[model samples]
Target: MTKKVRSVRPDTSFKETALALIQNRLSGVPVVDRQGRLVGIVSESDLLPREALDDDLLASAQAFFEGTFDWDSLFKNRKAVALTAGELMTTPVQTATPHTLLRQVAKRLSESGLRVLPVVDHGKVVGMVTRHDVLKVYCASDADTLCNVKDALEHRGYVPPRHCIDASVHEGIVTLGGTTIDPEGLRRALALVRAMDGVVAIRNLVRVDSSAG
Candidate 1:
């Protein structure tokens, strides 16, 4: 489980809390109380009903040129609706105890369509679980095996575009990163990496240069 957790207070404004979720690109935020106990879960679905406009929402998203977001105007015009985390959150939240089995947690989250799960211990929020963390656990195989795989790839025609390309193997999972390329290249590279022995996954930070520069 990852140490990083995103949380909000029950009294937090709906707009403010939703903005925080967007800022983090998180599917949901844990609603905590004064003592940091998990009370509810707030997700994007909770914000969608308000017809709120995000800070980066463009009139025409495809067009590169757009006016700056006037937050003050948005607020004054009541474009920003007032909501509290408590009013918008989902109660009886599905949760996992700290000692809950990983497979169980994965299954529950998968079936429920929840992107993140709050790790609770003694009825208090302690950590969080996301799909990425679950995948990372299975993808990192072992250090030496990952290094050998990287070496084999380098020997083969696959190139690591940046100094950041790294490999890790733990429990037969492989993670690769530190490369930059277009989406097609990334897909090809990751496919090749997955072809290696004991490579169960690849964590890619490969950036695509979309500019015509």
Candidate 2:
């Protein structure tokens, strides 16, 4: 998730929002209140249909079909007029929490067809997660995931002789096998591997030795 997010206020004008999107090179931005709570989101698709009415391309197309253009009626159309973010933004926005699992985040983005999802905590926007962010996890190599898991266990002092944990990765699923003298160390190792990116699941074949301390 991107900690720094580009957002706009509800009262911000459509022109300003469009300019912000252009300057930031974003397709959409979340609408927030003065307190920085996400209320809605506005996108280029929301504005493009209205903005297209004023474009030369639209005029040319209209001219090709009709003998004359109704300039006065076009100008009078409410959609042609610049509105505010509050008027244009879609509400009841879908969001994700910081603790949300990567698989769930990916599922939501796929089902909703949303490019970005605001990460919220305690009812306030904390960061933003994009499809690219989720994709990075899925794209991680199995070897990389296994190496990271082993490194994490070693860092936590779950090593051979004292705490033996061997890991094997096949298509992103990790199978942990061996013996652990310390149950706490085994738990920590499992937790570390489970939390790792690209780890689809874990198979725990480790036998815990409660006698050894």
Candidate 3:
């Protein structure tokens, strides 16, 4: 999630809104009211319904030779028909909160087809999360996950030593095989690995047997 959320006011003109998206390299911007309440959202998709004159594109060569290319005017005509952010923005905007789980945000972004989801606090935008942000967390390699798991165990100072533990990772799945008399230790280890990034599943073959090493 980003700490600084860029937004546009409801009365903001379409030209200003387009500049904001272009200058910031953002696909969308949240619309906020005077009281800082999220009223709607504007996205590139929302602005695509109104297209530019095809004749302008066809005359590109002629315009170039005549030095009559007015990009500002041409793009202005291409912008969405609605002149204000309020008119062009989509209402009932999809959003997340500071407390929303990362998985939930990922799910929303995936299923809802949103490029950027605003993170709100009591209807006011505080931050934003993008699909790229979620990808960064979940895209770790299997080797990295394995290394992270081993490091976690080492930092905890395992009592019986790590030699007795058999751990291997494949496709983000962790397989645990060892003998542990302490169920609490097994539980703790499993929980630790499960919470780790890129760990998709765990095969717990650890046995709680006093006679086993």
lDDT (CA) per prediction: 0.69, 0.79, 0.79
Residue 26 in model 2: lDDT: 55
In angstroms, what RMSD does candidate 2 have relative to the true structure?
Answer: 7.4
For candidate 3, the 10 contiguous residues with the lowest summed lDDT are: 157-166
Q: State, as a TM-score between 0 and 1, how close model 1 is to the true structure.
A: 0.51
Residue-level error in angstroms, candidate 3, position 169: 3.9
Residue-level error in angstroms, candidate 3, position 49 = 1.1
lDDT of 2: 0.79
Candidate 3, which segments miss by more than 4 Å at Cα?
Answer: 52-80, 139-171, 179-196, 207-213
Clashes of each: 11, 0, 0
Off by over 4 Å in 2: 54-82, 148-167, 170-196, 200-213
lDDT of 1 at 213: 24
Please name the candidate that would achieve the greatest TM-score relative to the true structure: 3
RMSD of each candidate relative to the true structure? 15.9, 7.4, 8.9
Better of 1 and 3 by lDDT: 3
Candidate 3 local lDDT, 107-166, one digit each (tens): 888987889898999878998789888778657888898888888877864324743556
